[model samples]
Target: MRIAVPLPGTMWAFDVISIIQIFDDDSVMYGSSDRPVIDFIANASSKALDHGMSIATTALRDYHEKPDLIIIPGFANPHEIATDRRTRDAKARLFTADPADALAIRDWLVASHREGVEIAAMCTGMFALAWTGLLDGVECTTHLPFLDDLAAQFPKALVQKDRLLTHNAKQRIWTSAGGSICLDLCIALLAEHAGQSLATAEANMLMMHYPRSVATRRSDGAPSVLPRPSRQSDEIIALTRRVREHLSYDWTLTTLAQTSHSSTRSFQRRFSEVMGVPPSTWLLTERLNAAKELLELTDLPMQQIALRTGLRNADSLRKHFSAAFGVSPSRYRQDFLRTELRPTENV
Candidate 1:
């Protein structure tokens, strides 16, 4: 599993290198020391640093072999970084990346992806990935501060502001929310490329619990939070987006197949092929996911929440919610209720 990191401009965070090191170490431990070769390929042979960080790597033109995966690290936001003695000279390179470099890197990524190289972007690195136009119509997320900018700039990209991770299995692109969560994304990518056992070992070594969404936790403690897009035709992807936006709507296999302009049998086969679940199962999962969000973010009554999420009533919602999350709707809401939002008892 050869890994590549592309360097276009400054403000390169350490995510790319950290991920490489972990994978490289695991390969060595598993007696494949020379496997998973790491390469830092750039448009230029050497890019000058802005005083805060430095890296030495080869030029893309000089590297002949294509990598199995490409990981782009988040570029540091200037406002987020304090201007201390080390980084006082660092330039603000967030959205204002060098156009020529960005274009060169974007072109390389587009070409590489066509040849089946999986791409993963961390935090604001998503900005660069978004530049490739592959993220258009694909679900993604970024650092909280830049989520709006990412959506505004790439109007076609489906930005999930609340999602900690998003994967377009069809395109083989993975994106994550910003900050240390990047490490969690790295472990996920690691689990996919390497084995899950190694990924679990690495997470334990790092003393981090694998990042799992409450709605998809497995008993084994492995991560199951990779909310994936349909890995099939555009019709399927479009159908998925529609279902998510209208979770409250009463939907059936017939209705869903008609919406996608396919017959019921064909739609079921295609949807299940890409999503690993039938249309009905997918719809139920989406509804449950929406319910969890409401439980965390709103104080709406259980009946209203159920109605809004297409779960019929409070009893149905409670049954499904507990089955998925191992807790009742009321209990789930209690766990996420803010201190200020909680009702005060009489003194």
Candidate 2:
């Protein structure tokens, strides 16, 4: 697989380097025996650093050999970096005065997509993907802080704030939250090309526990809780934790209310008010979360996973998974498993 990485001034160095290392390690551990050769190109118009001391890349020409995959790393601060005059001037010479580097990267992205090349962005790199119009009508994610901005910037894009990664099949765009998660995303791609064992080995070499499948959602509909700010808040949080701990068993709101020694109605209202969701909603979300983890990390079948997660059957599990995420439980597993197979393929 041919991979292109276009660096830009102010680019987060670690994002690009980590991806390169992940692919390299995969090749040594898995490809040395049977995988395809993974070709990489650090394509750029000129090598420079932005004021923020981030590395910048040169532009990729239209006639340049198209890569099988392209990765765009995040910048130190995408908002400020995008507005830098030198960065704008350099990109303009490559792309068209004051042309946004995001647009330049988008052109190559679109071209690569047309050729069936996979395109991925890490962290705030989703910002650039959004600018390209390629992510229009596609589900994608970025750093949590930018979720609202991303939605506002590209209304057509389904910005999933509560996800570590999101893939838009219709547009062939994949995005993941920035920072160390980029390593997880790259490992996922390697897994898709190779196999799960190889992906796990590579992750182990990096001292990382292979992430739960990339298909896992950040929100399983659980209430987002803040640390208890006072004694009353702490008591509520303690109750919430207890409920979460018992998710795999049959527990009811009345049961929880009784435990907390409050009237059921008052307890329900208090739980909703403190946790930002009702107790039942929170319990179901916790169960679904447990199910999701098992689905991604284990080879267990749907029936077993459902039973272990406290769901009655596969049908019940699917209802919750589909309602929480737009995809079925089985489909999520397949998507995640496919990524694991990448590094094992004849690279």
Best by TM-score: 2
RMSD of each: 19.7, 7.4
Q: What is the lDDT of residue 241 in candidate 1?
A: 73
Which residue ranges in model 1 land beyond 4 Å of their true spot?
Answer: 26-30, 33-35, 48-51, 77-98, 213-347
Model 1 RMSD to the real structure? 19.7
lDDT of 2 by residue, 1-347 (tens): 55677553346767867776787765455434423333333345444333434343434553366566777777566665334344323433332223554465556677778878878888877766666667878888887777777787668989888787776555567789876678878877765545445566677688653243344556532234443577655677787667656665667888888888889988887776565556776677567767766766798999888878778789999998887655798997897666556554332
lDDT score, residue 198, model 1?
55
In the range 57-145, model 1's lDDT, one tens digit per residue, is 78766877778789887766523322222221122233335555555567789999999999988877787787678898898888777
- Candidate 1 is scored at a TM of 0.55
